[model samples]
Target: MKEIAKISGIAYLMIFISGFYANFAVLESLLDINNPSITTANFINNHSQFGNGLLGFVMMLFFDALLVWSLFGLTKSISKNITYLASFFRLLHALFFGIALFKLWNIYQLTFNASNSVTLQHRVMKLLLDFDTLWTVGLLFFGIHLIVLGYLALKSQYIPKALGLLLLLAAIGYIIDGMAKLFMPNYIDYKDVFEVIVIMPSVIGEFSFTVWLLIKGFKKQRGLQNAKFV
Candidate 1:
């Protein structure tokens, strides 16, 4: 159990590192939200960097899949049924994220052909929109997964209640941002505000949880025997 906790924590850390680099550093850099022509030009000119983004997502997905198992192992002793539910949501998030990556691939393929610049830019823009939509869909499931995981953490003797509460707040932030992106037309107007609301909680909460898992997750501990949690 201790080894599993350590592994899951390490995997979580890797997912954040790779995902941020890929999504923000590589992919977002290549995209011009205001102009599709410029975005297509970036893909055609910086194909290597675009490929690196794909590679980064692949790495994130690999670790994400590992966490799906290790997290279940870590939490199952607390409540087998709830742990299963949490793990299922995380798996669904991974599948949705994988489909989003597929959209990235289609955009990357557009770089090579370049038969019609106008048509090419349009297709790339559409694919970029598709990727964003799909990723937002994935985040909805991820938010639910975090909520359940937070509940399990609160019931674990090894986990801190403070950290568990932070996880719940972060989960709410994620769900709010995701729903806004999907349903609100004026989301762009409030994008920065929404981003900050989500970022503050998620970055602090998840990073704190990762540190705890590395430092104390291996210690021998027991789950709460409360009937409500079980």
Candidate 2:
């Protein structure tokens, strides 16, 4: 089990890095800074036709898939106490990914068709809004899963408790941010601290945890390897 956990964690971590980098680097680079919305709209209008953005879209699709895969591996590594919850969360994650994939398809249509018709743009915009709604819900589920999984890790002797604690804190921040975004649009601008407090720590903690898991695997402390789900 310990060995499995280590290997799985490493895989998850690698995919996480790949997905995030593709978005932040390739996708973001393609966007125009000055007129982000218009530029993105145009990009969608243009490349989406002959699948110009196909590569990027596929890459983004893989991100969610990787996330789901990682979560599954993480859940398997942990105790069985929360196995059901973990599975549930993974399902939610996959659902969100599906939603995102559909949205991307719509975006492809909007971009390639280039009708420049207000009605079409409005329809695409509505689809985009629906995608955002699903994404936000998925985030909430993801956050909850992390918090619970982190708690499990903290209690276990296999992984470091500090890493688990950091995950928990990060989950809190995500939940808060999601709630604010959903309920209070006006408060969106004030979430700088929230983003910093949650995102940076999470990236660091998860990165460290991933590295450690890959390199050191898990310890045999407290007979964790053979223990049944508590």
Candidate 3:
């Protein structure tokens, strides 16, 4: 169980890193008004954009699988039936990921035909806008799932309470940010500010939790082993 937890943790951490670069450095630059100069865009397009996006998608797939595994592991670690609820939320989480993955695929398709044609550009821009809308809705669902899962983790003795707390905070931030984008799309781009302040901290917290899990596994593993010995 410990070994499995460690492996899952490492997988999730990789997912976090790859997803961050893809979203922040690639997609955000494409959409945000605060993007760098054309030279920077050229450098990214020439050097690492496709690779990063592909890698991020692969990592996210692995992360989804690992999250399923972790849900089961948490069930065993805590010896509780509430993990059924956790598992349900995990499924919702995977669904959210699927939506994002589909959007990524559309973006990749658009990349292939990127040219100075007005029609193609307009179509691509519409796809991007739709992608943004889907992502916002996905985040709302994902955030609710996280809050429920985080509460379950907090109640369990195997995982650290800090991780659960961070997850809860992340859920709250995501909910607020998603809603703001949905309802007040013209409210001074609070989404950008939320990403820097609230979202980044949540990412850091999850990163820390992943590192801890990868390094140490769950706290109850050794106790369970000792109990077996006795």
Give me the candidate number with maximum TM-score. 1
Worst 10 residues of 1 by lDDT: 220-229
Instruction: Please report the TM-score between candidate 1 and the true structure.
Output: 0.95
lDDT of 2 at 29: 50
Candidate 1 overall lDDT versus native:
0.89
Q: Candidate 3 clashing pairs?
A: none
The residue pairs in collision within model 2 are 44-111, 45-111, 49-112
Model 1 clash pairs? none
lDDT (tens digit, per residue) of candidate 1 on 46-85: 8999999899999999999999999988888778999999
Worst 10 residues of 3 by lDDT: 35-44
Q: How many residue pairs clash in each candidate?
A: 0, 3, 0
Which residue segments of model 3 deviate by more than 4 Å? Answer: 32-48, 76-81, 219-230
Which candidate do you rate higher for TM-score, 2 or 3?
3
Error (Å) of candidate 3 at residue 191 is 2.5
Q: RMSD, each candidate, Å?
A: 1.9, 3.8, 4.4
User: Per-residue lDDT of 1-230 in model 3, one digit per residue for the tens?
Assistant: 76777776877777777777777776665553433233233333543575576567667767766777775664444534555666666677666666766765665665563543556445555665676777777778777767776776576656678888888888888888888888885845565686665577568666767787788656455555332110
* Better model by lDDT: candidate 1 vs candidate 3: 1
